[model samples]
Target: MSHYKKRLALLLLLLIGFVLVSCGQPATPQTVEKVVTQVVEKVVTQVVEKEVTQVVEKEVTTIVEVQVEPTAGPFLERARTDGLRVGFVQEKPFGYVDDQGNCTGIDIEVTREAAKRLGINEIICVHLAWEGLIPGLLASRIDVIPVGMAIRPERCEVVQFTDPYQAQGIAALVLKENPKNIHGFQDFVDNPNLKLGASIGASELTIAREQFHIPEDRAIGYSEQVQVIDDIVAGRIDAGMYTAPFVNRYIQEQGPDSALERATPFDSPSYFNTGHGFRKDDPEFVQLWNNTLLEMKRDGTIAKIAGEFGYTDADLLGEDAKVENCCSGDNWQNRACLPK
Candidate 1:
């Protein structure tokens, strides 16, 4: 009994000890490690997905903002801050250098007065050829053309013109000898053999093309109006077409020896109007110039200058003169006129 009881008791004690030891020991490190690794992997995957989505959304939004918004050009600000660079060609009554080499003309004087009102500190006159005025302006070499550029449809596509300050009628400049008996542009139409002369890229060219149906080659463009007058006197051209007042002034200044006479006469409301030319980017400057021109016309300042050039109030803009009618769109002639 004693031996059997001792063996059984020993076995039971060994079994209980094994069970207690097994319960006291911690679980396998690999099991806990695997659970922690699974949790960490899930959190990492969620974070990576969130980050990728956020970055993609941010990039798309940035791209759209960059594409849609366009900033303004810096031209107007620079012009006002650094003063202005005005351009012109030597043309009587509009722009010319005086005997002293200082720039002086009706348009030049008007522009100077307008610049004074614009709070500009300085004005630099740049003398360029007529054909180069617009190209220079577009290239940023010049800020404006104060040569009294007539507002026309094709030019309006490239540049912005201030409200017209003056208006004038069309006429033909012919020799006093009356060789061809040409009185008007209509005469050129009647006699298709005669070639008419005008400055290149001028409203006269348009008139010859649209109204008279004259071909481009027959228009006979010269670089300058003086050249046309010279050619007319030499009989290279039968007649030269230009503004009536311009021809009159040329005859007056040339004296009786010029042998040039202004024959046909025309006036408003069938006239061409001119204003200062500016780059299309600098609209604010054009607005200020137009406002200043209006003030000059109202204050008799324009009249004083006009008298110097033999222009009267009739040449000056009427109070009701509208820029839209001048050359806003397709308003080249009767198409643009407002109802009386």
Candidate 2:
């Protein structure tokens, strides 16, 4: 029996013994009833407090519990609240800050629209050096690079890309007088001493060095496009290079009195396709951009943005403009894979 039950048994035995001892004494039946009633009530109260009440309270406390959030949110969800930081180089038509200090271009507009639709409103534009764009992205200094970086084999090994957005042909820049008589990559080969100037880490520079076999010593790298022009004017380099649209824009902006001119008779068999460049690890986020770009393309939004930058529908990406088709081993920027 329980301790409380044993105590009750002992108390009953004691009460019986007392009753027998007081049999001949003046012990009334009313006094016996009152004593028994008090003993029973005390035992019941002790049992309720010790067994029922304590156990019930403990069970209630355990059952009425809630879970607390222990971890932080996902990166993309956090990005929705935080600003989406975008990286860009000062390349015309694709991305740039104008004389008025307004940041606008095809890539910038495309990024803005895509990010906005994805529920990210604030876009922090980060201007980086042309060569620093990829490294900065790898280092997490910026989020993405939509500055028309060509989706080439070398870049494919370093980072990832979306479907091709636009195509650009390589162009040569020279003095107005055409002193070097440079026309194409072959001209650079003909003059072994002819120093070629292109922005460092540019696909154009890669083409000159890798495709044309222009030796490293002959291929000079500059931090800016303007530096190439400066070195060319100073006669430190025999020729400079850029995309056709970029060189043409520079020529037009400089007017008729400009010292530099686009090297005429320069043409390419293929166009280098470019796209939105981002980190390889974030496949889901990259897919979001690709989906939005598809929407833009279907609704003529991409074409409209292109037109703003002097680009036409012809400049639009071809159906075969994918990463694999655009980049193949050492043969970077496959012309056969892209539109003419």
Candidate 3:
């Protein structure tokens, strides 16, 4: 009995000891293997998510940069951002405010086309007296002087000009009755008793006083062509002289029954080349206009505009016309009359 009992107790005690050691020790592979697998899966998932997020961010950034690069126009975008400010005189045949309050005529038409090609959305014309154009340009109040300004050297020294676009002869206006017998500019020169009428700041007065040797007292300057023509009609002055188209425009506008008539034998400082004027600082602007004008002339746009004002192609300058010395400078010499 003792031997059997001792063997069984010893076996039971050994088994109990083994169970207690297993409970106190770390987990076996069955539970621990699943936890390690879960941790590895989480790490891989985080790495893949981060890589995808970086690639998506880069793609989004590239797309934004590619969508923003255009709409700036040619040559000094800021200068014409608000559009051009053209200045014109209210002189017939070149520029004038019509009864409808619209600006019309040769110079205005030419300028409007150039402004359109330059990408300007607006053309604002400031009406100034003939004498005020140069000052208005220098003061920056005006961008262009498209008032059919003659390209005199004295004018060249102060402001800038586009290449000559017009060349013209001068004509005189007299009463239809021909009481004064003023057929041409020379008639005024020959008759000391006669007083000649010219617009203030016009090339006509300069030519009369300087080129023709007419005394200043015998020649008078009026502010507008109407003033000179009015005097001629009223007989306050013997004759009024200006560019041929100018006198013709007044006569035509006044109807067939008007007392004014074009005096015979047109005279001149001879072959005055006229151009639109601008500030000297505007070389780019002037060049732009020059190129555009040449293009217009070549394309027949210039001829079309001139024709509207009763100007023939002869009234327009050729594509290569340059300012010659015929009546070029402040001395106002008719180089044709000078010693060659």
lDDT of 1 by residue, 237-262 (tens): 88788775786577768776878776
User: Which stretches of model 1 miss by more than 4 angstroms?
Assistant: 1-81, 172-241, 255-270, 334-340
For each candidate, the alpha-carbon lDDT, in order, equals 0.71, 0.75, 0.72
Q: What TM-score does prediction 1 earn?
A: 0.55
Q: Which candidate is the best by lDDT?
A: 2
lDDT of 3 at 35: 41
lDDT, candidate 2, equals: 0.75
**Lowest summed lDDT window (length 10), candidate 1:** 331-340
lDDT of 3 at 76: 40
* TM-score, structure 3 vs. true: 0.55
Displacement of residue 286 (Cα, Å) in model 3 is 1.6
lDDT, residue 253, model 3: 74
What are the root-mean-square deviations of the candidates from the true structure over C-alphas?
Answer: 16.5, 15.6, 22.0
Q: What's model 1's lDDT at 7? A: 41
192, model 3: CA deviation in Å? Answer: 15
Question: Where does candidate 1 clash, by residue pair?
Answer: none
Runs off by more than 4 Å, candidate 3: 1-76, 173-241, 255-267, 324-340
